[model samples]
Target: MNEEIELKELLQKNKMYQQVLDDIEIGIHVVNAEGKTIFYNKKMMEIESMEMEDVLEKNLLDVFSFAQNGYSTLLEALHKGSSIKNAKQTYYNNKGKEITTINNTFPIIDKGIQIGAVEIARDVTKYERLLRENLFKKGNTKYTFESIIGSSDKIQEVIDTSKRATRTNSSILIIGETGTGKELFAQSIHNGSNRMSKPLVSQNCAALPDSLIEGILFGTRVGAFTGAVERPGLFEQADGGTLLLDEINSMNPTLQAKLLRVIQEKTFRRIGDTKDREVDVRIIATINEDPIDAISKGRLRKDLFYRLSVVSIFIPPLKERKQDIEDLVQFFIDKYNHLFAMNVKSVSSEVWSMLLEYEWPGNVRELEHIIEGSMNLLEHEEILTYSFLPIQFRNKPQFQSERNTKKDLDEMLIQKGRNIKPLEEYMEEAETYYLKKALKHHEFNVTKAAKALGMSRQNLQYRIKKWKISKE
Candidate 1:
């Protein structure tokens, strides 16, 4: 009698869940405590390449073929009454087609009794095949101004400035966090400018040692140093074009002085060579962090910064341009759909919510990666759902907003149920803390602290008195 009731409950569960599970992006398979298939969604059927009649009520081992004995994650979960997550499983289907999947399996327990197990599977066969082919190193380099993807006001501001900059050959500085597409803006400015026909050469300041870097920027004459060749540096090679100095803050201060002179004079001497060569190259530089912080740390020379920033363009981070996420998401989905030859329509509302809630520390690049990865795991479903998200996103809370994380601060602002403090009051308190730290770091030397903080000593003194900030 108990077995009959359990079977009835299983049938009801299969009917109730099939509609929801079949609509999700990943595959779903469920089995009974006795290892008999209880539910198989459409996605699972396509993933395993098996018929409904062939799987339902049939033993898992009898329906599927595994090269290794006792290798079924579903069977393990059912027997052990345990949960297995994010395990990569490889096996052949009923038709002998090799399949690769990332599986998350869990047991269903009723009171103290183990009833069955459910397994979620994501196919990664094509993604792994692409990795083995070594086809990722050479990416398409041609990026036009249209290639930039954003419609936010902050982004449009930079775009407008960059477009105006293309009309002039003045040195330009592009600033943003890493993965924020600094190179894209630089290439766009170059491609749009009159120097479009000329060659564009770029060198990373942080990729080599100081000694080797100088030689790289300014060509070395034969016998200039050990194994030195008669090679022309980036400046000579990029003559009449654009030369990109990437992460300029990482360049040595001395090298920066030489660079400043070259920008001012349009000439540079090769190492161990008596003669100087002239290049009419348009200079473009990028800083992967705040230029003000770079100056404070003495990583970038003040004079060099002043020169390079003649036409400054700042690319806002993903957080600062939340309005663009939807556009970028659709853009990448369209992009990967073409590359992977799949027809994924869109993400479900639940999945969409998580994308916006994410802080996006890696900015647009990180979003692109997450989207590409999710696309790789799609089954027969057209829309991406919660099931298709990465394990990190799946395991985390249901997308906490930035404001939600600072509830304590909000409470302090409304203590005793008083009206909240004005924005400037909070700003003043923050300034007070910052000034005190700077003063203490400089051992109460107001002049030095003011210089390091990029403010006039008199101005800092006035604020220090205004906030009553002191060593004590």
Candidate 2:
């Protein structure tokens, strides 16, 4: 009788412990050595669209018969008595709905005896759906000329030139430093043109190797090469539309020659086929370096450069357009405020001064990131201050070279002396700066940032909370 009572108490304790796991968002499942389910959580039922009665006490492989072939992480873990982490699995459920999950499966061992296996799953169906929807079907553009956020003469000049280019079908070459919104101009020009209803396909020339880029851009024919199948390339896929070739200088000279022929003749021959396939695709190529420098260095062919530069546009860097910094900062703050569901109303004078002084090497993208990082850290505070800026901005060494002369340094020192604050205030600002910079540098990946900062993740999280830093 006493043993029976003890068994019931132990089961009650186990149920109490399992309740915590049941409330989590990730799906959890456990099956014994016999493959019969011992535990199933509410999230698992929701993820699989199944009821508890249908899964509990059922054989794991029998419940998910698709896994009976020993291809699933659960089955692999059961057979190997080892852990499998982040194994991506795709299968159809009983209702014929395709499900994809990133799963972590591991065997559960009690003492030296194998007891069961556990599996945790995270659903990524919505993410995949978004990717597919954006890649095809709609052929819609997300940004137009209005999305370009600057009122400076230089920026307005580029926007005006881009607008003019939209009326014609001539090839355009965009030259700008990294992060100067070259792609933004390309998309805006495409969306504003007569081919707005057609697809606007984009490919980075630097992203693929010479061997594959040809096939991807011009496609292949059946029996063209050893296993070649008939396939439509980007040119065909983008027929009657626009094709934006980003980082055009990175394309191989041989591929450049072929591209030049296509640009001039308005036709291309597929690999392994002698017949020519004509395509009407408006070309917009972007280069992150000076065209002359690229040609001189042999990274870009002279003839190809001339062919592409018929209509050229240059976007100035952020440092060159200091007049637009305030406007850009406000734009980003508003954007992130909407995204993060916060009410950040104003920027502190100290922060504004700091922003103006810093030379943004990453340009507009870097400014956007800085604003985003600051907005994430905002809590109840309505005003953004120097304390919210990243460490890269607070440190002198990072911006000392940009000060340029002794006069500038002296003026900066005078400004600092006039604005002398309390030691505790300075220390707090320093801490917040380092924390924000670390988080930003790691792309808001808390685990990696915590490791780099030489602190435990939990402790860093606590500090983030206390400092009102943004995690997302």
Local distance difference test, candidate 2: 0.80
Per-candidate TM-score against the hidden true structure: 0.56, 0.56
**151-237: candidate 1 lDDT, tens digit per residue:** 566788888999999999999999999888999999999999999999899998899999888888889999988898999888888
Give candidate 2 misplaced runs (Cα > 4 Å). Answer: 1-141, 396-472
User: Model 1 — TM-score against the truth?
Assistant: 0.56
Candidate 2 C-alpha error for residue 173, in Å: 0.2
Model 2, position 331, has a per-residue lDDT of 60
